[model samples]
Target chain A: MKQRHYKYIVPILLGTLFSCQKSSNNEDFNQIVEANPIETEVDVSSEIAMQVIEQMPSPLEISAIIKKTGLSYNSGILNPITHMENYTTNSQKAINFGIYATDLGYVNMYNSSQDAMNYLETVSSLSQDLNVSHFFNFELLQKLATNEQNLDSLMHISTQNFEEINDYLAKSQRGDLGALIIAGGWIEGMYLACEVHQKSDHKSLREKIGDQKVSLSSLISLMNAYKSNPDVELINKDLMKLQNIFNKIQVKEHTRESKVIEEDGIPMYQDKKVLTVMVTDDEINQIRTLVIDLRNRLVK
Target chain B: MTLKRLFISCFMLNSFIMSSECNLEEFSKNAAQKLAGYTYLKTYKLDASKEAEIEYSYVFSNNTQYVLTLAHELETTDILVSIYDNNRKELCNNYDKKGKKYFQGIGYSCSATGIYYVMFSFKNAKNKCGASVLGFKK
Candidate 1:
């Protein structure tokens, strides 16, 4: 027994020593790994997925159009900053983050500093809850909001901050939360359009509202991608009801020629297409009702 | 020296190589610089090959103005950007009135509300790498 134990110990010690010396040096380790390139399958699906989500319209565009329509800031139509506390779950917080972001955009476009500051606070809170506070510069944004003259810079900063937040979420494998934020923003934008259109008749704004059918489809597709998540399933079900209504709306597309013209020695090209929305007053009313119901479910 | 340590180093090196391949972070930073002051909506990476076109479908609302900016290594690459309506009709391409193809950006004032596609590709690009940023003003 003693002889056998000694024989085993000698070989074990020799093996350990050889192994340590083999990879002990940094240069040798590097060379060994270099000689045999490690196979790593790069997955950029997260980046691509985020890119697709970003393609969805920014609620800011809708808010900007509403502003251009010569409409005053109807504070009543927006989600109140007070509702910020009701969002307890990650899903709720994510969606409300989107909702507050749209509200902030509307207020900013109208140069309503007080409302902007309020919504900014709510946005900061939601972002913090989601652990994305690092992307949001609350102090800087507050100072920018205080000075109305810096609206452009403020918009730029806010947009970049959101982009960073979404990117970080995607990288961290929390893309589902990012999607909820976008869906929330889209729903709020739709709600605003429905609300404003119900109040006034602006042909351009009507067309813009009707055009949301396409975006709604995109949003549904996005949500459907994560239908397995219970939170996502609930949102998907609600959006599908809107999708069913949108299916009835017809969009007539006409081909048009695009031409490039020279302006100040630069080539300027203006491409326009003719799309006629065939939706009756009844159809829009149905949409408006559903939008209110959906948004209420989110806010309440 | 241990098997576990060797495996860990290999994994680390693999991640390093993967990131170093395209360096998307660097590309995004460069693109972000060009899109400064503009509210960035999205960024798309264009492959270096002229034939490698990337198309994105977006809902371009009416009565709003959109600006699409392209960023690339100035000395190494050139990219062409274009927009088309839902009807597959070309709205705008980064081409001069003289039909010259050298251009970097296109601005579209959308008067019609519908879905549109923004397409990007390299134009006689030597490096075959770059990105484009989208911004809109209402």
Candidate 2:
């Protein structure tokens, strides 16, 4: 009787242990990420990719530009949960992770507690799906979101978590995911910028929108690193099209000829070094339409 | 009975591995607060592996006032932070070249939108384990 029971217990125990080991590996994101076997010539080293990733502006910084325009808070722009169903690929999940997090940044800046909580949940969920939940302090973020007084703390913590996530992903084997995250945040920021321009028609905001051309170049470099991945390729392709439009927009610099000059026994740093973004209303409209169209499809 | 022992052992190993990841949020948050009135933007870590000097880059926005500061484990540090533009032009350094002094932080208001580099170096100080924070005000 003991010998016969041995076979049953041994097999069942081994199966349970195997399942535990699988989940403990934390490769859930790999399943959807490696969906495509297609190969391409484009490749970039982690060091190069990380440089681009770090060089890009923080998600909060991008959101800050939008807030600086004094644009009214519009919850309707938040990526609806219905579109989340389309996130069947790792790149999609990573991009939406950035998109939702950008929305969170925008809301926190506006002090929208209800919207902040909702976005916190979404960001947390996507982090888990991307197998990077270990970096986020969801519990602490939840506490901070509950009180308006903790808004700054909430912003800093939330930004810190995502920043760490991006840093790690850029250096890790999933460098593509990191690039996609940056790409997603940028697209959402652009979408919001376009939306804000439509309502407020803020001049500084328009210059900032034109200034995105600089960031767009960096974002493309990051995406090109992972162009071999079909999902990343799709994103890079969309950005390349946007790049065509951006190519026409010229941002001329009005920098002081001298960096520092001695005046009356004192050195003075140049005070009026600014870029004069020469973006016409027609070009702005084109950027708005293309950004919205791409943003809508990705959100869905 | 042996199966039960194997299960427990696996569980313990898994728990240990999962708990090993470090959290640097507190350190970064504290470092960012030193920016004083400027909102936090980003953080850069300088590890022991970086020899003598390390460089990092950021694409700063136009017409934005930014500050960079470093905090280390030591009570005092000689880590000098410098800011530069894409052309390798040194915009400013925390070190007072004329006064022969080194400061832990520097501030620069970007007048143009493009890539900017920051370099950190120790002045005869061996410890390189520290982090720097970047904060901005529009």
Residue-by-residue lDDT tens digits, candidate 2, A112-210: 988899889988988999999999989999999999999888988888788889989977889989988998999998988788788888888888787
Candidate 1 C-alpha lDDT tens digits along B6-77: 999999999877643555556755665655334566666666443567777677776566677666677756
Q: Residue A229 lDDT in model 2? A: 80
Instruction: Indicate which candidate wins on lDDT.
Output: 2
Ten-residue segment with the worst summed lDDT in candidate 2 chain A?
Answer: A1-10
Per residue, candidate 1 scores C-alpha lDDT tens digits across A216-299 of 766775665455467877888988888888788887877577665644333455554656787777788888898899899999
Candidate 2's fnat?
Answer: 0.43
Residue A231's lDDT in candidate 2: 82
| CA lDDT, every model vs. true structure | 0.71, 0.75
Best by DockQ: 2
- Across all candidates, the chain A TM-score values are 0.81, 0.80
Each prediction's TM-score versus the true structure: 0.75, 0.80
**Which portions of model 1 miss their true places by more than 4 Å?**
A1-48, A255-257, A263-266, B1-40, B43-55, B73-76, B84-92, B97-101, B111-115, B124-131
Candidate 1: lDDT over CA atoms? Answer: 0.71
Could you tell me the lDDT of residue B60 within candidate 1?
76
